[model samples]
Target: MPTRKIRRTQLLALAVAALTVPATAALAAPVPADAAAAPTAPLAAPATTASTTTAPATAVAASPTGFLNLPTSLLPTDRAPHEISFQYRNDSAGDQSIAPQVLIESPVGGPFLVPTAVSLQVETSDGSWLPLPLGIETGTLYTNLIPAKLVLHSHHTLTEHYRLTVLSPSLGTVAPRIAFYG
Candidate 1:
């Protein structure tokens, strides 16, 4: 009976010690500062002012004068009736109009003809250029994708020279070339 009582006391003491050990350790540890503080409000951003000076031009210069001067006989003679497309970005401020021209030259003994349809568009900074018919919105950056489709008869060949002429009132003229197999 005495031994049983001693065992019970020992078990109770061990359980109590185990329970208290974690509590004591937790009490002794330091609490992090952030844990005690209340949730903070987001900081306000500073206001911005417009600049008077104009931004530098970012359009890449075209090679070989006005034409996107490509190698001689770039398109295969066998590949007749081809289409050429170009993609570019214009981030100039203020309002501007751009006229793009797609030119295709005939290969040796090949037919030379003007493109059928040419597309020039300016996208707003928000990536919505088409749905809005107002043209490029003011103060926002834009991407202009201009595609010129040319139909050349079997006798007419593709020209190695192709150029995209960007006539902007604000940025002047920017001509970028195109080089494609077909």
Candidate 2:
């Protein structure tokens, strides 16, 4: 009985998430060439020296610069969470590192989303999915920052998986975005 209830809840959540996707929705902007060269703060680095800056973390992260907004899409109306895959391609000659972010559209002023699990996997020549080594860094769709652990090789594409739920009562749409920074 407990297992059945869990499955029902997962199905309900996925159904709710999929309702937000438009029937003819199109993907967002493509990644630019210079996007791979964009510089970002180290994913795992501690402060060497203390106490010069007193600004808040949000203030410091205000509108990241030199970043490219990768393609974005909401949950498709016809597919379940597991059946859906977000793809990103690396057209450059060298490998490029990428990070994932999400944007939530809500009727309320502020909304919350819980990301249960996220994973990045690359596609093999034989059309198999292989998991990539993920980093310890964590981020949410609202934070617009997924750690840069997975790298896409030259002319290769990678797929990402996201399991998310909107904690708030108000319905909100979740769209995933990718950012390139190598």
Candidate 3:
């Protein structure tokens, strides 16, 4: 009975998470040794990182500067996160680093999202995470973007993470109302 209940709960959480996006191998199987699916866009080989995008503890992350507006309909919670890597050239001042912004959005019905915690991580080519300066909050659809002076260099991959919650009663009527870090 206990096992059955646990399975049901897992399925429920997975179902809710899947509502935001298609299931990826990491979230579907969690085989850490296996490589995740490449981006829909063309890309290079995956590099092993001392850091991962799955948790706040492992601050190692990738850049979000590619997409003009990243859709989060299937955005897995930062806790049981998904990883996507994309290459970026830091074309900011001196063509060395850039401070990027991430806008958090949810499915229609305008779910009230509060990014309790958020970060944009840039991973260097040699498998090391560049230090991210604190982000400044600008608006509701987005808040708290990486500061302007954080130095990021060429040939880097970027990842993003956010620990958030939906505040609308319509979005949180179910039992596990908040997403917890895995």
Candidate 4:
């Protein structure tokens, strides 16, 4: 009799386990075709004009003189003695005159030769600065010629510094240091 009870209990447990699996599977089954094909509601459009109106205007600043606006790596390296020149213009709407100057220094702690043929012109007005015609040689391997001058107005005085180095056996480098005064 005990064996019969044990067998009955085993059969009941197996039946219950089988029934639970199918019930769980039914819950996980895919939705009917009618529900799967239903359309989703569209998302609301973002507000545009209000956001733009609240944003602040961007400000642009002018670049200082003598500083290379371009990356140093972008400068040419062609194994030649090069001449670097400096010029400034006063684009201010007001009538203001500025005196600009250029100076050159050698890293070797000696006076670098200036190109005798090159004529530097410095001019200033109530509005802008201009450079006179000058000659600059390009392409050669040497280090004697660099710039050393204080190009400024008669009443205004300032000093600037520059450095030169050999970029390649055939290419050279010219860097400018500039200063300004009223």
Candidate 2 colliding pairs, count: 0
* C-alpha lDDT of all candidate models, in order: 0.24, 0.38, 0.28, 0.25
Worst 10 residues of 1 by lDDT: 1-10
Best by lDDT: 2
- Candidate 3 matches the true fold with a TM-score of 0.30
User: Distance from true position, residue 35, model 1, in Å?
Assistant: 71
Q: How do the residues 1-182 of candidate 4 rate in per-residue lDDT, one tens digit apiece?
A: 01110011232233324333333332222222234233121111111122233334332111211221111222233434334444332222222222222222222442333334222322222222222322222221121111111222222323221222333322222333222211
Candidate 2 residue 149 C-alpha distance from true site, Å: 2.8
C-alpha lDDT (0 to 100) for residue 79 of candidate 3: 47
Clashing pairs in 2: none
Model 3, 23-129: lDDT tens digits are 22112211111121323222222222243535674242233221222333444453433333322332222223222333343334654444443333333434444
lDDT score, candidate 1: 0.24
Q: List where candidate 3 sits over 4 angstroms from the true fold.
A: 1-73, 77-79, 90-97, 117-143, 146-148, 151-182
* Residue-pair clash count for candidate 1: 4
**Residues 16-117 of candidate 2: C-alpha lDDT, one tens digit per residue:** 343344431112122233553453533222112234768874332222223434444453323232323465655555555555544443434443333333
Worst 10 residues of 2 by lDDT: 1-10
Per-model TM-score versus the true fold: 0.21, 0.39, 0.30, 0.21
Across residues 1-182, which tens digit of lDDT does each residue of candidate 1 receive?
A: 01110011132223333333333322222122243122121111112234587656542222111112222223323223322334322222221122223222332243322222222232323333222011121221112212122222222222221222222212111223322111
